[model samples]
Target: MKLIIAGATGFVAQELIRQSLRHPDIKSVVALARRPVAAPPGAGADGSKLKSVVVKDYDDYPEEVRRELAGADACIWTVAITPSKSKRLPFEEVTRVCQTSTLAALEALHEAGVGRPFRFLYMSGTAAERDQSKTPSWMPEYSLLRGETENRVLAFAAAHSTPSASAPPDFSACVAKAGLITHSYASSLFALGLRLAMGVPSVRLEEVAAAMLQQVTTAHGFEKEPLQNEDLVRIGRRALGEGRA
Candidate 1:
């Protein structure tokens, strides 16, 4: 299957691209980034199956860029301004990158003529609120906005779903709401203790990528809409084990 890894420069996006290249069922990988992405070390071995497509802006897609994205079976969207990282940027910029870019990419993909049953996996954080009406005391604005974005994406999927059995589903979207990502090397004892004290769940980076690929590659797409942290951890572990064997 042809997979598109959007926001290719991010930590998670890079991992997704790396895993997709090694995946046996993945026929091609398109790395979509604002800037050019250098081929990862081992990715060159599958040189023929991997390619990069650079766009001037995430909110704008030129005709040529759309043409390059045509026929893609799935897209893993990792582009978003995390709450922790949004402190330094203006709220407008964060909203544009986190919310506007998402819808723009989806519209571009549709206009590009991506075939039926196209899968879109959005990378959202576990703390993101699902209800926009009630805001949490902590980071209320950011959380609400993220929730609204998720709702928009889910609504888009519903709008595109096939009305009858005779027609194929136009689009299938899944939101993977990950928690604090744990790194084998960077996660120290202090960090682990802090997370535990705060009651925040965490998952390894590898697991996140594995779980996402498994969702799209399966014969049937994800059974649920927003996959929680525990679900990802479980699926990711299984996917990693299968890949090793």
Candidate 2:
């Protein structure tokens, strides 16, 4: 099966790309990003299956980019400005990167056509609240924006769900609401500090990547519409132990 990893340069997406290249089921891996992406080290012989597709802008899908994405089996979207980074730019820019680009890609990919039951896993944060009426206690505006994007993605998929299966192609979308994504390089103290400040649970980077890969590839379908941090931890641990992801 072919898998597309958007925002390939991200720390989490890098891990997913590495794992996907090595996985037996994922025959081809497409790395889509603003800049060129090289197959990560340690992917072994299977690394040859990886291909990088550069896009000048995520919101614009020219013929070249669309052709590369044609007939894709699944896509994991990781593009979004983090809360910390959002503060550096105007909120408009943040929403465009986090929300607009996502919908644009979704529409473009669907228009380009895809394999049956096209699976899309959107990477969202635990703090995001879909209910715009109820403002979150933390980063209310940003959280709401992310949440709104999630709802849009779900709506897009539902429009092409099984009932309308051939709205040309079938569609399914799942959201991964992660918390602090800790990695091996970070000091435990720093990770703990962020968890406390953010007031959200944490999951290892490898675990999140592995869990998401399993969801789109090995699992029957999404384990849940929105896989939470704990769900990611559990599935990732199991996949790692089984040595499949």
Give the CA lDDT, 0 to 100, for residue 29 in model 1: 88
Task: Give the residue spans of candidate 1 off by over 4 A.
Answer: 42-45, 166-168, 188-191
Over 106-214, each residue of candidate 2 has an lDDT whose tens digit, in order, gives 9999889878878999999999999989979998999999999999999999887667532433689999999888886664557788778866688888899999999
**RMSD of each candidate relative to the true structure:** 1.8, 2.4
lDDT of each: 0.85, 0.89
Off by over 4 Å in 2: 164-169, 185-187, 194-199
Q: Name the best candidate (by lDDT).
A: 2
Lowest summed lDDT over 10 consecutive residues: which window, candidate 2? Answer: 161-170
